[model samples]
Target: MFHLLEKRIAETFASCIGSLYGLTVEVQTEQPKHSSFGEVAVPAAFQLARQLKKAPKAIAAELLSAVGPIEGVAAAEVAGNGYLNLRLDRGYYGAGLLAGESAESRMSAEKIIVEHTNINPNKAAHIGHLRNAILGDTFVRMMRAAGGTVEVQNYIDNTGVQVADVVVAFRHLEKRTPAEVCALVAGPARFDYVCWDLYTKISSYYEEHPDATAWRQETLHAIEAGEGVEAELAHLISDAIVVAHLNTMWRLNIVYDVLPRESEILHLKFWAAAFELLKERNAIYLETEGKNKGCWVMPGSAFRESSGDDESKVIVRSNGTVTYVGKDIAYQLWKFGLLGKDFYYRKWHTYPNGHEVWASTGQPRNSSPSFGHGSRVYNVIDSRQSYLQDVVVAGLRALGYEEQAANSIHFNYEMVALSPGTCVELGLELSEEDKSRPYVEVSGRKGLGVKADDLIDKLIEKALEEVTSRHPEEPEDARRRVATQIAVGALRYFMLKYTRNSVIAFDFAEALSFEGETGPYVQYAAVRARNILRKLEERGERLPDFRAELAREAMARQLAEEDCWQLLLAASKAGSAVERAVRSGEPSHVARYAFQLAQSFSNFYHEYPVLSEANREKKTFLLWMTDYFRAQLEHTLAVLGIEVPEYM
Candidate 1:
């Protein structure tokens, strides 16, 4: 149990060393490092030793002796490195796990908002955008598993320079008006793919002439004011391209609760109100002197490594227009409920997951769906923007809303780049500058990247080949359905496997692998477990249900015996893994848990006789264990945006 382990450790530490500063042992969960080690481990002794001025060995010895007597611990031993390692009572753990009471009972629900996948509406999505959506969506699922209320937001840059650039391309380059483009969009050629090409051409042309930047500025104003022809064209472009983004994300099983547009942020005067508040409090001041004359500034950003936190940054420029930093500060404050402002929201569409993708509008409605005022806001962005995001939080503190600032998070992730071979596969001829670099950059400005949908198609096609090879007799529709799930698992897990800070050098061949340490591997494990249950059902031995069977087996005196320890031990640690996975914001725990669950099931499968066993009671118990893992693993995989194929 999550609480059981923590409680047992707390009792042991408190009872043995009550004299040692009364430091409570709130948790006994392992800080998972290498897999060769057991499922759970603790280094509490090291900390206790440092605090108590005792040798770590002696403290571990004391703690192990003190903790071992507590229930559910199969063994508690001090490791050679002064780490206190604890193993669970397996049969006890596994039996309790099957009952599902442990995790259900140990949860405190809190609301969390995860905003991600704010892909610019100007072009087709790429693998870079995939990383953001995959991670954000997975985190939302994980929070719910931990008994938290999660609100998923997908930010849309509908009025940004990127979208404006696309508008410029259609009007300036091709001379097509809004109505002409709308009529053509009703016909064949993919609207987003067309926009992608047009947007890229405009980007390249922008490099040739500096004066072209004026069109972008004018479009931004027109977008704000809701002006004529070009704005209508922009609206048509944004609407059609968003459909493209949705289709691509649907392939990966990612969905959003809301889609907030940047235009609404401006039109609603969100930044304007936030600016007034900052100016009133002197959190930001009007700089009438120096090169920043007539501009407003927020004195310091938190990420200025060696600089004092009290330093300031500019909020408004000399032209009286809000800078990017100012807009972000306003957004962050609104997210945390510090800004006395709100949006007029309209339901855009219902996403696949049964949640509404509500869009914000400038004018207030008589009644609208609630938005903003989150207790926590996690902005899933790339590491490059960490500097600016920190300033958002800093601005809050500067205005005396320390709690709001504390709740603002920069959930930074590294950029995705293409591997050399995969780069060439995209039909780009390599030059010295390209081949010599370790990885290829995905430049959105130049449109040099693999489209997200294209990658999903490739992954699905490859999976289809493998699935058909093994199940050639299956119906075409059945195979199609299974292929989609496998492709999703492959892509989602591939996106999550690396730590957020590590660069993902995207490789098609590597990501498509169905073998070890992949999403397909996790799916394969669950599929095998499903097969066992199906086979058992065919044999007329119905799979022992979750609790009824486990309750019956709990009476068996063999559970008190030493040999039953391993199964219980494996079962008991699920809660700990659940807690750690969320606490650390890492999916590897879920990955490792899925692998270990499968591994344990396999070992039990090999060791225990089910249909062949003479001991009907023990066979029933074994089935209970198998069913327990099957349920758990399926749930865990679901959390990672993975599906367990029935036949695969």
Candidate 2:
């Protein structure tokens, strides 16, 4: 509601200024430094002073006279060197809050495809992978709350070097046949965990004997050719690992609409189609000399200015195998429905929510939902791949899809590391130098990072201890369920509380803390609100039908009070916060808003004791305010993918 009022005020000023001075400019709104000044302040007159060749105060006086009254605005006054200070209609604003209107109302028919959690299907998901998946999933939730038709895609790099390395480990290190590997995948053993260990062993083997790296090349060829035991075993291992990755994500309520596999890109000749387009458009050229001889390279200018061919990116090698960026180019084109080819889709998995996850296949199913062809695409990747992401977008521009290239967003974030304290908690041996540093980086190749499941299990165990202590006589099953919810909430919120570009050295002590700026803190606020109503019911007092009992006049009368007004205003801004977070492409904004709202509620909870109120009318009003806080808190938590436990 605050967001809408701000926009309406801005637009009104823009119209008034344009009509009065015959000038047009973008109007920006901001809050008053002190709440007593007004609700929103605009500085349009300052910008007009330059063009009008008049003092800002003179221009502001004239604009105020020319601008008419705005709906839901009590008064627009000139203040502080031509700034427009606008006060809201308190009665109307309070009434609107009770009506529960959406603060943001952007309706779009175009589809938005968000591709995230593109972990290599070779080993277990690590802490770094958790950061990516959590950020992506939370963004998806935000988009949905903002009323977007979104498709979540999880790109699988089955034919990439990571999957090939695992295959090499199976063939050379473990010396396992295709049948034996299939049995391992089908057995009760954790296949991804096995590959996690084998991957590290293969890394060490390569370091000891560099010549043994040729197996990677051989395995790559077999996988690309889609023939013989190598390809068969590659599919089995990658498919099984993909399921394992999905299960790991599912524990945190992360689900996907499709899994676009690299093998399908090769098998369905997506790269060949993209290659011809690139060649025809001269986006790539065959080099006949220099270090890049016999390679297809895109000019360096597409990504950055260069002095010569050395800066150009290689799309295909001398052996005619396509590079990773080349494959990415094909995938990008398909995302925009420009590849002229589509992946064959089949049912991969159905989540508990009844959402069907589809995967790319060599053969099409009889009935498959249309995938891809999004107006916008957000590829959630870490900051390390910024240069590569640039190259991929450059390929799109070179192919003449300038709009699609521009719409292709790289929602990049920094990597996640473990704090030194967290490393100690994980039982990792730290050197004195490492202990001195703030964080310790984990390497998947060295099998040093904590697995996602292992970390989740630890959080649950810790949460369970807290839960058990809080409710000693509670049923065992209920305690475990509540613990799991709190654990998931803590993990997701910790991953989301940081800005995208900020590196996080995750610490369990900070995340699991229930007191300050944590998920559990915000969640406990909601539970407390609920507990208030529950206590009222237990005391044999029927819950008030707020809609019938609390009239708009009654709400306005109470909201006129300063303390009550502030808390109600804070609780009503959740929708506005969500809109801001979605528009800025930052989930941290939502987290910050949740924390602020929780703090406001905490203050309100202390200041106004609803159950112990002396007056009947005031008590009913306080109860209604508590109800509003609970509803809004849950709505905001849902956007963060955090669930409120029944007995947290």
Candidate 3:
């Protein structure tokens, strides 16, 4: 609609007063901040004040008089401040909108891989982990809205220090062997939760009792060597923790097409292949002097530096263990098809959507599709790792693989923290600085964060209370099911609402709210639209064929009459929102858009009677308009990993 309005305004300016400056047309269409401002505001006089050699206000006055009549425009008037205010011909615009029903064909798609939720396979997922998964999944949905090829990948840090810490907890503290651990997993307590408590115990113990660090070192070596009771338990305990993480993310609708393990890449010698390329291309030099003696490093900040100058990241420790950064660079090389290497894959699990999930291993895979040959890769990690990620891109550029480097992106976001009240609820102590800040830090090793399952259960219970109050006669099972949908929506949307850079002081009560600026608010709006459509079907007059942007005057008139142009106008920007999300690797924008769309439609529904309007044509027009908003809102929310319940 703005596109149509822009053309009409531009033609009016260009054909009428625009001839003086010989200007063709380039009228901008931006929504005004307040209803009193205008439907769409443009300031051509400001642009030509110097070129036309006149004051902006005088120029605007001339342009207003010269502004020709457009069919769907009620009037084009110059503001007192030299701004051009264009009010649509409400009746004509509404009627025209209803007449044309075809939507613009969605954008042509592009292939994109979203790598996120690379949580350590060491403990149960906490609120911090939830933030990453929710945002990452929403980003994928936003991309797909514009017909993007999105493949979700969950990176598993099976060989990192965090995993080593958990292994230390099991062996040194729990006194459990691999065979005995299998029995323990069959016990009542969830293994992940058990590990969560044990992990924090180990962390606190090691800080106070220095000898505990030695045990961690031993476990690390045992893990790398893949020998002893430590090796056996490492695989079992690691598998259990990873499963818990997967289950937690699944609650938020975060699914993965691949589970890339850091350990598998090491076992398959993919890093070795990457090393060979580094030596072959002479990109990484073998340092024999000064601080980096015996280490391989690519010299040059040709891009950005992770640390100060003269500092080098050690690929191989003095003891021969590979650093995490080194492993990541190798994995990145394989992703771009640059190392000329491949990892063996076996179908570890099948997704709910029926897609097979393949994991990397050294052994041959009997049933695995081709993976890791993507044209582009997006790594969704937090901003603290910005320096390291920058080096990754630099490493590729040094190897003469600039195109691959260009395609690799670091989709970094801020960490999640707990609100003060939540910290007290979870029974965590905080320091002066922590108290000074707005929220409490969620430390996994300290066991100080909301458990994903417990949060979900609480949300469901709360939602059920509200649902029962609204529809007391509904069956208990049905109510529970609907509550689950709303619960997930509320949780997922809250997680996604904040910008990637903004830190949320996640208040459980604040997040659980169903009214005003919330996920359920959006869900409620969508439900109302759906209900309106359902009621319309019950009536004798069938809805006329309509496009999202209809040219007929009647369609435009109908839209304006509903006083809900706010939703129609905002919904039209979904494409632009999706494009920005993909380009910037942020989905919080989409979440905000979804909320705004739903709120606008909801307010309109509350104020306007769709079925009971005095004018039958007015009622039909409003109902048709509601249907489009409903479809777009539902689709966008789903992309944000939110589910609109049948009732809420």
- Model 2, 420-500: lDDT tens per residue? 988888888888999999888888888878899988998899999999999999999999999998989888888999999
Candidate 2 structure, TM-score to reference: 0.96
Off by over 4 Å in 3: 1-28, 35-38, 43-109, 289-292, 298-308, 535-553, 556-567, 570-573, 580-585
Listed in order, each prediction's TM-score against the native is 0.90, 0.96, 0.88
Residue 405 of model 3 has an lDDT of: 94
What is the lDDT of every predicted structure here? Answer: 0.76, 0.90, 0.77
Q: Count the backbone clashes (under 3 Å) in each candidate.
A: 16, 0, 28
> Model 3: per-residue lDDT, tens digit, 336-404?
777787877777777677766677777885766777777888998888898788778877887898888
Point out where model 2 deviates above 4 Å.
Answer: 424-438
Q: How many times do residue backbones clash in model 3?
A: 28
Candidate 1 positional error at 5, Å: 2.6
Best by TM-score: 2
Question: What's the distance in Å from true for residue 45, model 1?
Answer: 4.4
Candidate 3 lDDT: 0.77
- Which sequence of candidate numbers ranks them by TM-score, best first? 2, 1, 3
